[model samples]
Target chain A: MMKNSLMRNVPENYNPYVSSDDYKSKKRVLIDKKATNSTVEYLESYSDLFDKLNITDGMTLSFHHHLRNGDFVFNAVCQEIKNRGLKNMKLAPSSIFPNNQCLVELIESGAVTDIYTDYANGPVAECISKGKLKGEFLMHTHGGRPMVIESGAIKIDVAILGVPTVDKKGNGTGKIGKSACGSLGYAESDVTYAKKVVFVTDNLVDTLDDYQLDGKYCDYVLKVDAIGDPNGIVSGTTKITKDPVGLKIARMTAKLLDEFGVIKDGVSMQTGAGGTSLAVAHYVKNIMQERGIKGSFASGGITGYFTDMLEEGLFEELYDVQCFDLKAVQSTLKNTTHHVMSGSRYANCFDDNVVDKLDFVILGATEIDTSFNVNVTTDSHGKIMGGSGGHSDTAHGANITVITTNLIKSHMPIIKESVTTVTTPGADVDVLVTERGIAINPLRTDLIEKVKDSKLPIVTIEKLLETAHEITGVPQKIERSKEAVGYVVYRDGTVIDTIYKID
Target chain B: MKRGTAGTLESNDAMIMVKESDGLKITITSIVYDFFHEQIENVIRETLKEEGLTNVEVICNDKGALDYTIKARLLTAISRMEEEK
Candidate 1:
């Protein structure tokens, strides 16, 4: 066994991100001069663990959303912390979900005074949008999250994570047991960097067949009855969108990708779990299967569709950071080609990231303007709905970034005078594919020149905006509020845009 | 007076609930209420006026449906509310 940066006795086959690239040159990561906790202390309860750690105010406690909307650890721990009347504790979860609605109470009670997450929505988001979160509610990208964590920008006092299965030595994996939500990718850095790390598990086995996280970092283990509801841990199954307008937008996006030679052999791609984005993958899959073209790797939050491709040999491998559905979780258990990459390895800026190897990525937009600035961070009314999970990271890394959406929905046009908030800049955005037409960013003249001769309904941004107005009619402009709820940070760690609270 | 219902809650489709009342009263719940609530109310007013319908209550449950879909649903609901039973 060889020692890694965290001084874990990594198995011979264990692969770590030894070096990182900054686009031009590769730099080596620092090695551990000292060792971390090599023994795991098994605790039975969160309160006991909290007391053992001396739970205090103004502590940055963290968790991961691998359990998605079904997670129980975050809520249970928050309730305990609230029960203890702890004040001013900062939540540093990787992302927040509806199940994490318990955070709303914590926020209101002043138990959780600050929040630092990559994406969020539902009650906690609504509370944050209403300007109820007393402390700074800052948003970061998935990649930027790890960068800041390692840089000690966001100091985490304790990282209490849920692990599905644990070995006697405290090594954990999210791939087995009842609440197996695969790919403990998001929690990897948390376990490695936090001052104290705890793994709460429901299933204890003699040994793990494979592991994503090392045991050296784990200082405590709390065995519980369950970590989360299995049914709610991940999606039942993801299906391609059958929405007519969505299909049209997706078809246009696929055609544009094909016309631009993005569907060729050895191509690497990324797509979200959105129906329209899935439709684009469906269309592109048919083309790849028809031509018998094999690709390299598909990365990011993987779905069953991409796993099917891996099985069919359409792609060589899948670099999954998080599993979006149950099928993906199963694939991680059985498929040898399915590999898990840490969040930093996935898209951290100033590091060699998977997105840098991405040829194209299909993403959605809550709103887009003629300038190609895309906003997934808020609704049309400027309420906090989502932040750049990997939107800007993939956009910045991919050779081509495509935004797919209907020109108008419910009489509201997507292409407007300007976006409600800028989650990704126009420089990174390459093409906008709507059912009405497709618009290429003028910055990407190379793409424009290539697709100019194609039969795709390529149009200028202004024409698309005009068509949107014709269908949706001119909408009344809502006044932007003076108070800012929060700010969106780009992948490069810059404040791309500030979100205004909806009055 | 009998009640009539038409349309659906699907995206780009609005559900219309119509019934007999003392005077025309239209209440709308639209996803785009912030931007197009006034427009949706105007569409209902114009459609009911053109149909020469009076003493009725119209409720529109909108899910980002377009103006034409809303109008069609309202018209169908009006006919249903007036049909012989």
Candidate 2:
């Protein structure tokens, strides 16, 4: 049984299906600190680090996706572990991208058995969806991962962080380096709470003046040839869609935002990095320029477009959790108003964060049902393609949550009778805007009444579904096995839906 | 064909033509007609009735305009037709 010093009435193996209200108020364990007086040796090779750390079977390890698809440290560490023949270890990454496909060999060799992550794409997710993993794949939201770890539900034996710059004393930062990927926010918990923390980087500097990760949290620091690919870490720029239909929806969305009266001064917002969602930013930019309105802040996955808005005085500040493009990285380092925050400060539900006070958030959805439940995890056939990185977290926290997607994607209707899996509950979602029309959740009578006078089309989700069916016809149901392969856990740690095996 | 016509083919805006007739007759061509035809026709009819003109022929070429934008365009055409009276 895990000992929770914060909660007095915690059950053994305390994992419960509780509501957000119940879960958010639970006691959380404080992070353990390591105080050592002797001079600690920080430099080591991969083999020496592994042996000294006593890499063993059935232990948990963590990694962060701040390096994104350019990351090379995860594969390097796993390779060393596999060479040492460690087995049955659990892999908890903040998120997994296509570059982490090397995990396939690690899983097949029995070196990795269980997996937990906020988001995943490409081969690893496909392998997990096919039940190739030894245990069920547990999916979490961006906020939920920190929540579970702080509650002592999952303990990490070691946390290997891939940083861009580090000193001899193990202090590190992702702000300035040849392979800089701004904001080491996602790895904050691993360094703070893990039993052992290791910093692996390619660029070694002599100074410790400006560092995001303090040397106290990290036990060892290792320098390598390359930590990540520069081209893959951050794109040159983020782009909006050229599709006319997408632009039309973006226009309507901007108009709707104005009608809601939240587009004025002091409004706080967060938008996804999708094409359509970025298009919403473009239209919103025009509206702000036209009205001379300056927003309080724009947060979340920061892109170059947002940085441009900051320079143009469209937004007063930009709160960046992760930098998605080069311009965003440069802006966070250059601008005083562009602030870098830890993951907990960004979206953890147990503690107060920026998400709790957001006025609006624009999200992308793969499927949305008549009840306003959303599925950003799977495709029409229930294959894993995306995950709830922060979709559910922001929706749960924001005053108004709007999902933007085309009515039909690849000849299949997006507004279904029900989603393949519910990533964000209907109660959290406030509105859905497609190219055809906008549907406000019946639960938000305040929004419906607010937009009732606007010329914008306000219709029921049922009406949108009917219109979709009229265009695409009823889609064929997806087939899957009876056994469950994955579990979609809501941000509060409740199992909202089960994903079946697709074979 | 004796009527008043105004506006252009701008995106998200509408062009309309109004002429005298024995009864109210309306024709609409819109790229978004499938989703908003009823809305466009209602706005056109309401605008004509609000101006106390019942016997008229209204032709609207809508390029996905909203209800209010369509109504404003129709009213502009109605006032133009009255200008030539």
Candidate 3:
């Protein structure tokens, strides 16, 4: 069995054997010195690169998911491995998206047996959900990912970073290419900690005066025809939900932000890209405009709306860790105030990150219990779908963590007696705004007292639960087998919950 | 006899279609139907009653619309149906 020293005692029903603690960092005797000329080394093809590296079985490979559904590096590297007849390699990616379903074939063929990730979705996630893989999966949070990698708990053999634009000397940036993806935050840890790092890019410019990633972190530079699909690299648009109910919830959330003085001048915020969160941005923009309030910096997964705010002078700057759409990508290219940040600087709890400076954050959830505990990792059924990619991290860091979601969704009441899996502890969550009303966590007595006389409906979480139950009769508890699929590690490196295999 | 419709198939909104019917009957389909079915039905009923029309059929597809939006859409649909007549 794989042994792990960093693995905390997971809350019942999970296999504690994560991975062996015998992680040996790949030793580097010397750093590459700058040459008089551009002495950057390049590889002709993936075959040549793999042949030179002599990749063996059971070696761990790492990747970042900044490109989302557009990335080609993962597939290209995996296809090379398959062609080379390699097997049992541990696939460690920051996250897996719908386009990474090619990993299903890699797992089925035994090219990849083990997986480590902060998040996983699509076919590969489904494969792991069904226990189709030969080995266990280690699900870490965004902050936990860099923590483990940096602490030498999970040594990476090779990390392949895909960039949008690159120079001949391996200097690269995701901001100025056809497939620009805003920030390379998720790739930061892998580049810094991996034994070997490769820079793969499609837009090889003649010369780059400055780049986000310097050539110092790279060992090899490979040029591909297309690093990723630009269409998928950036969404065409990030529109707020037009649903009046969603609008109402969003309006109430904005009102609370303003009432609580979270929307004043020099405010800092982080909001997810879910419909309601986007709507919150829209309404918050209106409030900012109406009040003549300008914010200090807006951070996290940025969308066009946030970029528009930056341009409109609502916010002075944007510390983008990930761009959610094309407009955000465009803003990063030309706007110096729109800065790209590494994952460690973005939300890693071990470091002083941007999340620590956040005054307010708007998030979404699949389920929230009466205690305000949130579940975003699994569905109503006990299946593996998502992992915490800065969910709990921002929740822990933000001054006021607000969860905005419909009270009921897909015929299931979102307000449950207890969540299926506690991804974010209730103590970190401060408020919940639903279409029906708003419920403040009792722990935040200060906020409750402040908003007590607000025109918005202020109700107890128990009352919300009662209303939900009255609507959708108490739902049956999801069934699960004795087998554990994954463990949900909190932002601070503790195993808060264990995901059981769906029965 | 007149027929009118309001709203769209948006993420968090609902659409209501009011048609001249022989009897008072309301059909509500929603993403959150299990929880908000009754509340949505009440909004439609009260809306139609205020319009002084109990002989019309109401077809509503809800996308988690709040009570106010539901009432507003119902009233708008009724007003359009009246304009058609």
Clashes of each: 3, 0, 1
Could you give candidate 3's fraction of true interface contacts?
A: 0.11
DockQ for every model comes to 0.62, 0.02, 0.09
Sort the candidates on TM-score, descending order: 1, 2, 3
Model 1 lDDT per residue over A239-334, tens place:
999889899988888888898988999999999999999999999999999999999999999999999999999999999999999999999989
Return the top candidate by DockQ. 1
Specify the poorest-scoring 10-residue window by lDDT in model 1 chain A.
Answer: A14-23
DockQ leaderboard ranking: 1, 3, 2
- Give TM-scores for every candidate, taking all chains together and pairing residue i with residue i: 0.91, 0.82, 0.81
CAPRI class of candidate 1: medium
lDDT of 1 by residue, B1-85 (tens): 7889999988889999999999989999989998888888988999999999888999999999888888999999988988937
Comparing 1 with 2 on lDDT, the higher-scoring candidate is 1
**Of the candidates numbered 1 and 3, which has the greater TM-score value?**
1
lDDT of 2 by residue, A1-503 (tens): 22122111222433534444556576655554444222235657888888888878988999999999999888888888788888899989999898888898887777899888988899988887777888647888888887777666668888889999988777888988998998888888788777888888888888768778887777887788888999989998889999998888888998998899999888889998878889999988888899898889998989998999999988889888899999998887888898888777788887788998899999989999987889998876666888899898899889999998888764457898878777887788999999899999999999998988889988889999999777644554545565667777777776766666666
Over A1-503, each residue of candidate 3 has an lDDT whose tens digit, in order, gives 22223322364433432321111222312222222223557878888778766678999889999889888999899888889889899988999888887788888877888898988888888888877778757778787787778777678888888988888777788887777888888887787778877888888887788577776767788888998988888789988898898989999999988788778889999999877899899888888888799899999999998998999899989998888998898898878899999887887766668888999999989899987888888876757778788898888889999999988774478988778777787878999999888899998999988877888888999998888767645655534576776677665554667677764
lDDT at B37, model 3: 77
Q: Quote the lDDT for A19 in model 2.
A: 47
Give the candidate number with the greatest TM-score: 1
